[model samples]
Target chain A: MKKIVTIAREFGSGGRYIGKLAAEKLGYKFYDKELIMLMSKESGLSDEFIEEAGEKITNSMLFNVAMGGVYLNPGYNNTLMPLSDKLFVVQSNIIKRIAEEGPCVIVGRCADYSLKERGDCLNVFIHCPDEQKAERATKIYNMPEKNIEKEIKRRNKARSSHYYYYTGLDWGSPSNYDIVLNSGSLGADMCADIIADIAKNC
Target chain B: MKKIVTIAREFGSGGRYIGKLAAEKLGYKFYDKELIMLMSKESGLSDEFIEEAGEKITNSMLFNVAMGGVYLNPGYNNTLMPLSDKLFVVQSNIIKRIAEEGPCVIVGRCADYSLKERGDCLNVFIHCPDEQKAERATKIYNMPEKNIEKEIKRRNKARSSHYYYYTGLDWGSPSNYDIVLNSGSLGADMCADIIADIAKNC
Candidate 1:
């Protein structure tokens, strides 16, 4: 059977680039935000909304806490409760659809939890230090340094909440992920190579 | 902080033996049945009964189709349910307790799941060939050769069920573990040494 690789990651961890490199190296299809777009098409929701709410349970911690978290009205619902739920279901359905298609590299959106029972799947989590994240975000996305910090915090909050909402398990726990990579310390290419080797062995 | 080590394994894989050996090499406490015994003592349950119940989930799975599984009578429900729940809660609590005390070697019962958040914890899964299990079971336990196949299947059924029930996740999935070792191929001592080295690095 062809192999399925799922990559869950922190923002600015270079997971997308690493996944693309892995796909190119092994000649596999890559899925990232592309998955969100597909889910949007299927759910009849706008891609922009999916992009913003795709992998998050809350907007950001500060606002979430200030506005009673899930109680805040994101306009889709008085509290966005319905929209968030539908968005996750849509993403989950889309995830299974992609897994059914064949071997591919999936980035984020709790794809690991979606494909847990597949014997051929390899789940990887990519993480890096805060400083490294700020540096990378500033360099790649061309954001101001101060804004990079806020952006990093926002993305991480979203990723954690998204995973928690879906998997109902602690995110980044070594127990939840098969392999955890220190991408900032190891370098993205090295992390990708490690994953590729692990895929072969696994 | 002292390192933590978690060993997840299949039944008849000699996981406990390897864990003990690794602990000895590193001067860490080796906990196998000792953990159950400790939990029983802490929870005020008899050791024998708790031991039977602690791993009975495995036994149930093995014989589940034939025997629908053990359910405590309505009167015993209040007590036995807490026993079962306490087994897991105490297991998790003890793991955290041990990590707080110092490094320790924990075998089976999903210690890896228990210590997922500890930075120093080295989670490992010990595995071996099926044939090796049959060979060892017959030689070590004096099991009849004819019954070895049945024993292996039954034990695995129980183990997977036990692990899954407590961990709330699929068991024996390589991608869900940090490292997988073929102890039957590598030899237990070598496996222990290699694991010890890995633990040191962690």
Candidate 2:
């Protein structure tokens, strides 16, 4: 029943909250903001820089070269990697290493794609209605009501495109995920419990 | 690809709208209200009775007996079947018949479960945030704002319980369907286009 759970979600969908709760319920490690910090430490990149670059899709040919088998060829110098490519591969390696260590709950950052080949992983996407998301944004993030929609759209675009660039798969598509849960319908805590239940049954 | 698309959705998620639009784009027959009518005609039961019993989880012992093996034995008379059991079996049969006919879009009534055995079917669950759903309820159904939450919860409960009772599966679990789409995020029209694209790829 030890299964890695990867969650991809829309902005303000309570994805991070649900993932953290599920991880707690499952007694598994939760990764979200901490993943960026870990990447920064591992790559010797500033946490701020990693945070910014992490959500943005890189169009650089360097990313393509790195994804196209740079890691497979040991002759390539790791330090020579572009910042985006370095962050991507480093985070990917970390994700793989974590999966090898044990079951955990990971939120965002294309974790689903990172662990795509693992049969023991449960990939989920959490989303909600825009108005509910806006409310959450206003309440949880203390975001202005007027700016909620804009922020949501901006974040959604960044995450989806980032995922697309990395995985070559459409974000939130049913085929790419094991299940899609609407946090607004199930509630964050209940959604977490459901994910934990699935982990237990897995 | 010719495929049967089954949608399970929240009340104000614009599921019917998306299904109808997708059916139109795909040039496929749309089933929803027409399905209830079809069941009434086939089973000789009043549409009102079928409709009421359709989404209600019946506790009648007759339903259990009928489900147990009434259809297999020659001694069981069709007239003696409980109304709920009759509706269930009739609708199940109808769904199978429709799926066999050709590619089409079916909404609600647990069409996903009815067509589960078919490899050529795409199951989708549509949902929205409570606020967004409430807005839809107000505009579309003319539901008062004060009563919107109550109505949404009530309808959601009925749909999920009906699905659970019939399919022995959790409603809206991503594992149960190929994909779950949030209308609040993707919008109704885009969701339909995405479903149509998936159907085509299928």
Candidate 3:
């Protein structure tokens, strides 16, 4: 049985819901937005700040240049690190700690890349067609945007950029994940069921 | 129940094996290389020629330019159509006819694009990591290539180009398929099981 399941998803793809259902079916702890709370508590950063800056980087290149000087120091002082980099380190540590605790489902926040060294991790990506995503954003997410499609695209771009910034990997690339499921076509429940089944059997 | 299942895969991903297993489990007819015979009988092309040029295009751009003159005629006179285009049309018609008969599993030949209009079709793309694919090619396929990795890349590129030439869509894009399974991680049996389960319940 797989010990760790990481779900990376497109915005408005109902990925969090699928992760929750799969975790319930597998009887594993589920972490999504809860990770933000954990990170804030662990890092002494405000919850609101962690939520805002956790998964969305403003400019990765600039951040990299700014942090370049600090890389030479093996001691790696956290005070010298940028706030975004510090948050990522803290979040990654928490995720690793969670993995060590037991089998669990973690959604978003680059858990797949964070736990890449683990032998028993199952990485999944959930995506949907743009039309379906727009509909879900309006109906399920209740987003108050005039152009929900544009909003969805913007958020997805942010997520992708954030993922790339941290992991140096393309977000949502099938090669990076064990399985990629379309919630629109398979339905969220079936997607969750498949994840649970694969976790149990594979 | 899904009446049609279309699989697009990398060259050495064991996609055909997975499709066959899924079809058997679902009690559906499976088509892979068998479609070559059907196409040859319908198009009067030799099985050998179809096997060589069926899924690999020589040069799609030149073929497109040569066939451009025939597009104005809605009747699409076969005498004026290029041999490659003729082969594609015949193969697509055969695929459509097969779908019309009943539930079936088709491997390659862009069956997903051919049945894009069908509401009951499940399109799946199976992929594997390069290392795993190389190992499979060397061991399971018994390929006699000194550089198996290069051979695998060449075959995959040809498949991608052929797919793009015909469908004007990326072959393995997640949005174009319902689910993309990685056989390297999930194992072929579990991948087949997931496909069959999704087809039956979704």
Give the poorly placed runs of model 3, Cα more than 4 Å off.
A58-74, A77-79, B58-74, B77-79
In model 3, which residue pairs have backbone atoms overlapping below 3 Å?
Answer: none
lDDT of 2 by residue, A88-146 (tens): 88899889888888879988889889887887887779888788899999999998888
Residue B200 in model 3: lDDT: 94
lDDT of 1 by residue, A93-192 (tens): 7888888997789998888888887767777777777788898889997878866788898878778877887678877654565556667645676667
TM-score: the better of candidates 1 and 3? 3
Candidate 1 per-residue lDDT, tens place, B1-202, comes to 2377788876677878888999988888888888887887786667776676666554334443333333443555444333355556767887788778877988877777877776677667776767888887888877899978788888877777877877777676543555556676456876687567666643
Interface RMSD of candidate 2?
12.3
DockQ-wise, the better of 2 and 3 is 3
**Backbone clashes in model 2, listed as residue pairs:** A129-B129, A179-B174, A180-B174
lDDT of candidate 2 over B1-202, digit per residue (tens): 6389999998888999999999999999999989999998997767776777777655567654654423332336534555555577789999999999988999988888988778788778888777889999999989888877998989888888878877899886665765687677556876787678667754
Question: Residue B12 in candidate 2 has what lDDT?
Answer: 89
DockQ of 2: 0.10
Write down the TM-score of every candidate.
0.50, 0.53, 0.92
DockQ for every model, please.
Answer: 0.04, 0.10, 0.83
What is the per-residue lDDT of model 3 for residues B1-202, given as tens digits with 9 covering 90 to 100?
8999999999889999999999999999999888999999997777877897888874555754653422232355534655677788889999999999999999999999999999999999999999889988988999975989999999999999889988899887898899999999889999999999999999
Q: Report backbone clashes per prediction.
A: 1, 3, 0
Candidate order, lDDT descending? 3, 2, 1
- Model 3 agreement with the true structure over A76-111: per-residue lDDT tens digits: 653465567777888999999999999999999999
Best by DockQ: 3
